[model samples]
Target: MAAGPNEPKSRYLQYLEVVTGSLEEKRRYRQYKARVKRLPENYRTAVEALERYLMHFGPADGAGAMSMYEDLADLFEQSVADGTPIRDIFGADPVEFVEAFMANYPAGQYRARERNRFTSAIQRAAGEDTGQDGTDR
Candidate 1:
């Protein structure tokens, strides 16, 4: 029996699609890099640092990582379009800005511990943990 075109794709097929899309995105980003080199020194440095931060701490999934890259690229593109100075946009510390951006995603090595702490804080706020056992009953 042949699967129809409308049929849902298998997990493997979906994974392949994501991989292909990510590769395409990476190609586009490489082109973006060439453009970045023409930008003013401060803007170029900030954008490059941001790219590195995304590479290190962005989503683990290829698709998600590509999306993050696209978003960051869009931000830089928009800044260029708006004639915004990189220093004005990112302040005196581009690395700090990148770190702050990364903090929003909760990825990286400490994500699990951070998630657990967030869950515990929420549970505590809800008064769900009456004692150390953490039983609602």
Candidate 2:
């Protein structure tokens, strides 16, 4: 069969693979959300309230949990400077507020893994599976 104007049939297959992989990732996040839903009433209330005033100032990195810890720390400082009202912000105590909120925000470990969810997809699309020889990025 003749290839299309945009690319070969192989490219389409790679696109579909990446898309399906992403969908599976969404399901994982859904499970995580359900668990979060089960948190204690007071904690849930606080998370909900703080989430309503969400803001993400630093780079998400979106490719592994520890990769963005530095970025997450920066966001915390920015959050405080933006007058996020620590008392009303995080559900944790004042002593643990900084570390607690930094860990809870979308900048958490789960979120970090979620960010890297697409790296393999893009790698596969670019034919990088075999020692990343054809990978562009």
Candidate 3:
């Protein structure tokens, strides 16, 4: 079993928890949905649309995904309270907005090991030797 979020664990154990799923994560998800439901209709619709996109393009790790969702809910809830327009929240480009938002959660997509593999593969295909640090040698 994985340790609770408050408990310290090895990275490998954390990875396992993400892959296997956790009850706490499920509970947090329920709460997040409920919070979204409480938003104004327009905000709810906008949040749902962003959520649909996030399901496909956001974090891969369960904890990271949940944290992103929780924060997203918080942001929208606060926005609704502040009477901020949806366009103002995400700006002109939703994709850019999401990408920028996801940047804060580095465990999400194109993780470090995967990024290294991708870079190394490209270097090999180009007949170049990449240093362990990923620089072209």
C-alpha positional error of residue 55 in candidate 3 after TM-score superposition, expressed in Å: 1.0
**Cα TM-score per model:** 0.50, 0.32, 0.75
Query: Candidate 2's residue-wise lDDT over 104-125, tens digit each?
Result: 5355554456555567567677
lDDT of 2 at 6: 79
Per residue, candidate 3 scores C-alpha lDDT tens digits across 82-113 of 98999999899989998898788756545656
Cα RMSDs, all models: 6.7, 15.5, 5.4
lDDT of each: 0.66, 0.47, 0.83
Candidate 3 local lDDT, residue 134: 47
1-137: candidate 1 lDDT, tens digit per residue: 32356887777766875766543456666767777776667767777777777776665554455556656667777898899877787788867777776555536335555666778778888978635564322
**Model 1, position 58: C-alpha lDDT score:** 64
Model 3 CA lDDT for position 41? 95
Give Cα distance to truth, residue 117, candidate 2, Å: 25
Candidate 1 least-lDDT 10 residues: 128-137
